[model samples]
Target: MKIAYFDNNATTRIDDLVLEAMLPYLKEQYGNASSVQHKLGRQGSHAVEHARIQVAELIHANPKEITFTSGSTEAINTVLRGISKSYRTIGNRILTCGTEHKAVLTTCEQLTKEGMAIDLLKVNGLGEIDLQALEDAIGPETVLVCLMAANNETGVIHPLQEIAEICQRKGVLFFCDATQWIGKLPLNVEETPIDILCLSAHKMHGPKGIGALYIRRKSKPIQIPALISGGKQEHGLRGGTYPVHQIVGLGEAAHQAQQKFEIATLRDYFEAELLKAVEESSIPTKGANRLPNTSNVLIKHVKTAELMTKLPQVAFSSGSACVSGDRDPSHVLKAMGYSAEDAYCSMRFSFSKYTDREEVDSAIQQLKEAVAAIRAHSPIWEMYKDGLI
Candidate 1:
């Protein structure tokens, strides 16, 4: 069976160009980036620095501002841990929204155990943060405001600019997890006043296990002690031997993404095709201003897991890939005011520039068949049809 992949949000296939760019580093150029005397080490360091330039160019940031990491989760954890440790004397209070990924929520929970206060900002029914509530949440004791540029589950883009402005007015450092938004959407860090931003390489057709964090340079240079204590690396913020090949892959991927990011037309075609196939039922698209490549739809009367099982040829996800096994409904949908049932019935379909119109059509047909088959067996659908339980 030919498999149709619509789960780019979870992870993307590595681009051929990116792989090609990384071949030398993985094969002949293998050396420790920390080694200064050897030629091999210089080659590795050169590759890392070159990759840094690519990542920086993608976000319109200075290469000096980027710090390499394992992935978005680690980058986020680093920022959270670093900020909390550095600002604990002034304030131990952290603010985040209810719709954040497990990484952010779990990290905040860990901090709470260590005697820090955390405030979860509530969102409206559309999965948007309450701006007034965010404003009210920030106080002198608030040190950091954590938010995501786009939600992983719903594809809903947050009002980051407004939130950033709010944090700036309150003098609180703002951190944004731009993991889902970086490659799919256009971003300018300088224009958008953000203190810390996180990104992952795999989501943008780069190698897995490589990511970057953007730290705003301040007049006094806000220093957060190293997360991993070892040889000095990543400007002494993260101390470990760098992955040269993976960094090269990330850089190549970022360069490619910058060159070929035409998500709007492709996304529109997919959405139109899906709506055409399922005109009677509602397709739960994110509210205006979402990532162009994402589509979150609720197939009523069909369980998401059941649908997935029936449609084995297509690759999709019920929610964020990171929260796959949890029985609880998606916190993102819940924050959007979706009921438990609505959240459970929802499926996330994400596309990439590599996705074609034929693939979109194939996915729609498979989804329609899967929904029909599953709902036919569902007692809930039968009862609704006969008006009897």
Candidate 2:
């Protein structure tokens, strides 16, 4: 069976061009970037700096502000931990929402144990926080505001410009997780007033285990301490030997995504056809501005796990790939006012530039068949049809 992949939001297949760019660094160019005394080492160092410039140009950021990390997880930890400590004397409070990624949510939760006040702003049914509520929440004790450019599961986009303005006017630092937003959408850090941001390469068709954190240095300088302590690397912010090959892959991927083709046309067609074929199916966040390549479909009464088990030819997700092993309902949907049953019945389908209409049609047919098969055996589905629930 030919498999159809709709899980690009979880992680994308590395582009061939990115892999080709990284080949030499993994083989002949294996010299350490920290070793500048030798010729090969200096060459490797130059390659790393070149890759940094490539990644920086993609987001219109200063190359000096970029700091490489293992992935967005590490970058998030570094920012949250470092800033919370650095600004502890200025303020004891951090503002964020419950619908954020686990990395941000978990780190903020942990900071509460260290005497930091963590306030979670509520999201509406559309997974959007009230701008007025956000502005009102910023007290003198608030040090930082954490938000994401786009949600990982639903792909609903937050108002970055407005949020940045709010944080700027309040004199609090704004940290955005652009992990799922950067490659899919255009971002100009110089135009926006964000204090810090994070992005992972794997989400944009690059190699895994390499990402970057953007720190504001010129306008409103932020003094954040190092998360990892050791040798001088990443401007003494993150220490250790650099992964030159992976960094090269990330840079190449960024270059490709900069010129990626339009994807919303395919995504819209997929959603329209699927909704027409599948009974009572609807998109939960249709009214919100979402990523062009993502659609979270709610197939009432058909469980996502059962749908996946029945149809193995298509790859999709119930929620974030990081917590796929957990059987609990999606926290994101739950935050959007969905019940556990509704959350269980929702499936996330994400696309990429490589995705074609034929693959989407095939996946839609498989989904229609699988959903019908599962709902046929469900007593709850029968009740829903009879209006007895």
Candidate 3:
């Protein structure tokens, strides 16, 4: 039995080119990137710098602005913690949205314990933030406003230009956890007025343990103190030896994604055809601007877990991969005004450029069968048959 993968929002399979590019670093070219004396060390250092250039191109940022870390989680921690410490004299409040990944939320929670005021901006029914509300949240004590470029679960895109303008007008630092698209979507940080940006490599077909944070180092240097201490690495922002293979893989992945970025309309067709076959199913945020490859689907009257279990060969997710083990309904869905039952019945299906029409068609068929098998056992389905719900 062949398996169908539709959980790309969680993580992507590393590209073949990325793996090929990492071979030398893992094998014969093993040397520390920080060592500048030996030939092997020079080779490793050169590769690391070249990878920085490649990754920088994806976001239209200066190579000097990028600081590589373990991944987005570390990158987020670094930015939040560094800013929390550096900006203590400047302000005490940090502004962010409610629908951010646990990474940003958890970091904010930590800062609150240290007496920083963490204010969560609310989103509308479609999982979108109110621009006016964002503007209202900024005050004299506002040090930073952290928002994601795209949601990880629902794929709803925030209006970056407008949000940037608000932050700029108020003279507050703007930080974006653009993990969803740092490796995939075309971004121009210079033109967008973003002060800081962070993203991971794994989301865009790169290695898992590598990521970068972009701090605008233009006219006046943006000050963010180092979170880790010891040796001088990542321009003294982060300390430790670089993971050579992972960094090389991330660079190759960024190059490949830039060269082969395909924005096809398969998601529309997938949702249309899937909805036609699977009656009463809904596409969350269907009326809003969402990522081209994501679909948060609600197959009403059928529990997503039971449906997934019935179709063992199909691989998807009930929510964000971070909360995969949690039995509670998705915090994102609940924030969008979905009832607990509706949230439990919803699953996220994502597609990559590699996802073909044949695979989507097969997944739809499997979904219909799974829904039928599970709904047959549901008391709610019986009530629906009697026009009770």
Whichever of 1 and 3 has more TM-score, that candidate is: 3
Q: Give per-residue lDDT, candidate 1, residue 337.
A: 83
Highest lDDT against the true fold, candidate? 2
- Cα lDDT listed for each candidate: 0.86, 0.92, 0.87
**Candidate 2 on 1-389: residue-level lDDT in tens?**
88999999999999999999999998998999999999879878998999899999999988998999999999999989988898899999999998999999999999999989999999999898899999999999999999999999999999999999999998889999999999999999889988899999999999999999999886556888999978989879999998999999988998998996899999999989998999989999988899999999999888898889998899999999987778999999999999999999888999998899999999999988988888888899899899999
Cα error, candidate 3, residue 383 (Å): 1.6
lDDT of 3 by residue, 295-316 (tens): 8999888878778778888889
Q: Which parts of model 2 are misplaced by more than 4 Å?
A: none
lDDT of 3 at 55: 84
- Residue range 286-367, candidate 1, lDDT tens digits: 4556788888887666768888888888999989998878888887888778889888888898888788878878888987
Q: Give residue 299's lDDT in candidate 1 (0 to 100).
A: 68
Clashes of 3: 0
Per-model TM-score versus the true fold? 0.96, 0.98, 0.97
In candidate 1, how many Å is residue 106 off? 0.9
CA shift at 355, candidate 3, in angstroms? 0.8
lDDT of 3 at 22: 96
